[model samples]
Target: MAAFTDATRVRSDGEGGFEADLDPLWTVGGKPNGGYLLAILARAAVEAAGTQPHPMSASAVYLSPPDPGPAAVTVEVLRAGRSASQVRARLSQKDRTCVEALFTLGTLAAAGDPRWIDSTPPPVAAEADLLPTPSEAPGTGLRIDMLDQFEQRIDWQAVGDPAGELRGWLRLPDGVGWDPVSLLFAADAFPPATFTLGSNGWTPTLELTVYVRALPAPGPLRVRQRARLLTESLVDQVCEIWDADGHVVAQATQLAAYRMAG
Candidate 1:
């Protein structure tokens, strides 16, 4: 199996656009994962800017579910500054746009001293000590093929009674390196935290925002997800990604519509 990096690699289309093969191994419940698609678009946006800035922030709206196959990414640079560049990217399949994203690219500080902060890392056990989610678990429509690509250990204590909160340890299979791009995938990789609240169908994301704080170290990442608010049919999920070194690497918030099984 190819690593996630190679599977999501985008190549120049020779016409100022980028193209990539959307592999099914990254799909969930037979649809391409939004974060995976966002990573693809972010790659195209960074490539279009020609500045090689790391992904600082990305806001994406998923218009439709794209099939696992070839897709085109068109990028338009909104602004490029000395320290950051803003760009928009569109992902199209068969000439129908499926995903649109705005990205801010900039160099992350190699080392920094914080002035003030209030957030704290979530409590996560060692990967080996945590329980692995069963591949055939009920109500979890996760594809085994996709699960094979990642190592996930659930923190069942935090997930008590499906109150829309979950914490876990997640990482790619060996040989896949960690980067800001991969962090996008990690942000949305878990099953919807709302599922714990008895929501039993696909929760499709409408809009997702991810902020990259720092480069991750080599090891499993601690992911904490919780539902901030759930209205009639809409859910707001926030996720925090902490690297092995205990520093927060990325944070994500997504708005999705909840569906119930018939």
Candidate 2:
């Protein structure tokens, strides 16, 4: 029922770059949150591409822990075409890169193909029905409260049992728009184990990536996650995201460097 008070504010830093002030509301484990950085990265891409008749797809990488102050964003116009544009957005602190995003904007005029296809959505417990979510338990792994900000739900089995896979649904903040940009937001919260592993003490995102297939229509969002210990010290999370009708929406793969306990 509450809204995020510290929404990001974008401004020009001259030389064609932008900056977003980091506030307390966008935090994970009491530190700056990944969603905040991702949101700013996507916003930079949209601004650099200018306004389009249609939405866009964006992918980002988290390079380092962001400071608790203002974040400098650099946007580059990689390419421009009649129907699409490519732009790169980088978030930096102290002249070093903290995060980066690559995005594509599509031009549409609302006067083209009008065909439609119906598909089945992933099966989930009814909204009125009950569903399981992650909880805080002693050591073993991390616990998440997805219900706090997003509507998506992750069962305790995914983490408490540490099975090889993760399964759940993702939803937008109660009143957000249902566009490709919304898809970008839905896909942004995953590869959660980066913090899970770090939770043993503290670890920050080293890098994050998300791929887009097809944006889901407005409704409940679903996510299925599975991870493999690629090396003795590295973990790769392979993810599948679906819409409420069980239709596959997107897939993502991310690698996280484990942090030692503090």
Candidate 3:
């Protein structure tokens, strides 16, 4: 497996075009994870901006799942401002578009503290009480290769509950600390919140939006994800990631299409 930085790296082709080889280890059920693809696009967008270094917000729509191999990225700078830059990016393979995203890039600094706070990272069992997130879905042979790239502990007890919520901890492997770009991956690294409702089928993300609030402190990250609503074939999930120091670092929401396993 490649390092997260190396796996998401993109090289400039000198004309708003970037070349990247999507790593296979970032795939879930043979398709590249939506967040991983977003990270790749964010990296390219940052590089294209040439001034802004962080992706503050990214809204993406997944069109098709591309294979784990070479892909092309094209970025168009929409507006470059003194404090922020906006860009539109697309990832394509075999002449077909896979993911399209719009990103706002800027340098993020800690804003002292929140004046009014409401959302907090949900409490979970102690590390000793949680179970290691399985590499494969329970009772299914489908491989979640993405788990190999990080450390995640899941509260199985909560997974069995009727509530559509999951609490866990995650950290990058190989001592690679978390950065703004990496936080994009962290937002979607956990198992889908719908799993708590006993639906383990593949949930392909139709759209995902992530906001990077601040840089994470050194240590493992605590994560909480919940499904807000699940219709007959579509579900919406929200995820919040807090750094070890309990500061909210990132938040994300996604809508996905799913079907119950027989």
Clashes of each: 0, 8, 0
Which numbered prediction scores highest in lDDT against the true structure? 3
Which residue pairs show collisions in model 2?
120-245, 120-246, 121-244, 121-245, 121-246, 122-246, 166-225, 170-221
Model 1, 1-262: lDDT tens digits are: 4488787789999999999999888777667789999999988888899875688999999998999999999999999888899999999999999999999999886323346557777677677888676545775655545666778788886784347788998878765656888888889987788778877767899999999988887778898888888888999999998887777888999999997555
Candidate 1: global Cα-lDDT?
0.84
- All models, RMSD in angstroms: 2.0, 5.0, 1.8
User: Model 3, poorest ten-residue lDDT window?
Assistant: 110-119
Give each model's whole-structure lDDT.
0.84, 0.59, 0.87
Residues 99-153, candidate 2, lDDT per residue (tens digit)?
A: 8877777753322222553544334445535353433435635444433565656
Which structure is stronger by TM-score: 1 or 2? 1
Model 1 clashing-pair count: 0
> Where does candidate 2 stray beyond 4 Å?
1-9, 51-57, 107-124, 127-147, 157-162, 191-204, 259-262
Q: Please give, for residues 60-111, the per-residue lDDT of candidate 3 as tens digits.
A: 9999999999999999999998999999999999999999999999999863
Tell me how candidate 3 scores on lDDT.
0.87
Model 3 residue runs over 4 Å out of place are 160-162
- TM per model? 0.93, 0.73, 0.95
* TM-score of model number 3: 0.95
